[model samples]
Target: MDIHEFLELPHRFRWGGVGGDDCMTFPASWALKCVGVDPAEDLRGTYRTREEAHAIVDNYGGELAFMDSHLAKIGAKRVQHPETGDIGLIKAMTGETAVDQIETQIGAIRFGPLWACIHPGGIRATPAEFVAVWRLTA
Candidate 1:
């Protein structure tokens, strides 16, 4: 599916699940669609609480490191310019939103000028900018 179709997917974001995963899960889902592989497969459905999620992030020394390690498996390359459907890291360490309970960094997808993230209510546009971006090489 293309980014436009991905945006229309029905969702009720959850702390952990296959399709309804955490904040990063949203963009990670997009990456899966792009590459036909789940970079987060091992950790999905393994956490239920914020604390458990944080523990997983801590295992990798923090969110950035954790994501860097996982995304690498899918041939993710860091890029300065973000394009539509590109996955990115949105810095939330400053406590920008309550959705950031794990590693203080959330995942978002570039859709035009806006970044899209999965909110508890559903998919929503994020005001937070992409501090780092990755393009999947498949």
Candidate 2:
């Protein structure tokens, strides 16, 4: 399935599933798996922290921003489609402090690296709202 279809599946935010940042890495890793790419191999050691994940994405050659640095450089308008293997940059909610608040003011979410299945919640949507979807492309 495509990115939107995969994202349509249910998702739950388990901060400590595959890793602490599983919320970010799990989906991205799953997305890669859907495309028949083994994230363990293709994305090995790419992310030790959220910032590292963003850095890997930034170096991947997209105009999109992984964190505030690139976001400031490219702006929100850079986000377009929600393709598999694409990254979704979302803003963290107020009073949310899971990881290092890179760009808390703007809040950011990324759904890429694709996965085999979707999470309990669609993308980064909570019980209330779903923010923007940014597709990571080459």
Best model number under lDDT? 1
Query: lDDT of each structure?
Result: 0.79, 0.40
Give me the displacement of residue 128 in model 2, in angstroms. Answer: 15
Clashing pairs in 1: none
Superposed on all Cα atoms, model 2 deviates from the true structure by an RMSD in Å of 8.6
RMSD of 1: 3.0
Whole-model lDDT, candidate 2?
A: 0.40
Candidate 1 worst ten-residue window by lDDT: 93-102
Cα error of candidate 2 at position 5, Å: 2.6
**C-alpha RMSD of each candidate structure in angstroms:** 3.0, 8.6
lDDT of 1 by residue, 48-92 (tens): 866787798899998788888889988999999988888888864
The digit string of per-residue lDDT tens for model 2 on 1-138 reads: 654565565555443334322444454454353544333344545555545644566585432333323323322233555533433444333324546334322222333432232233434533212244544332
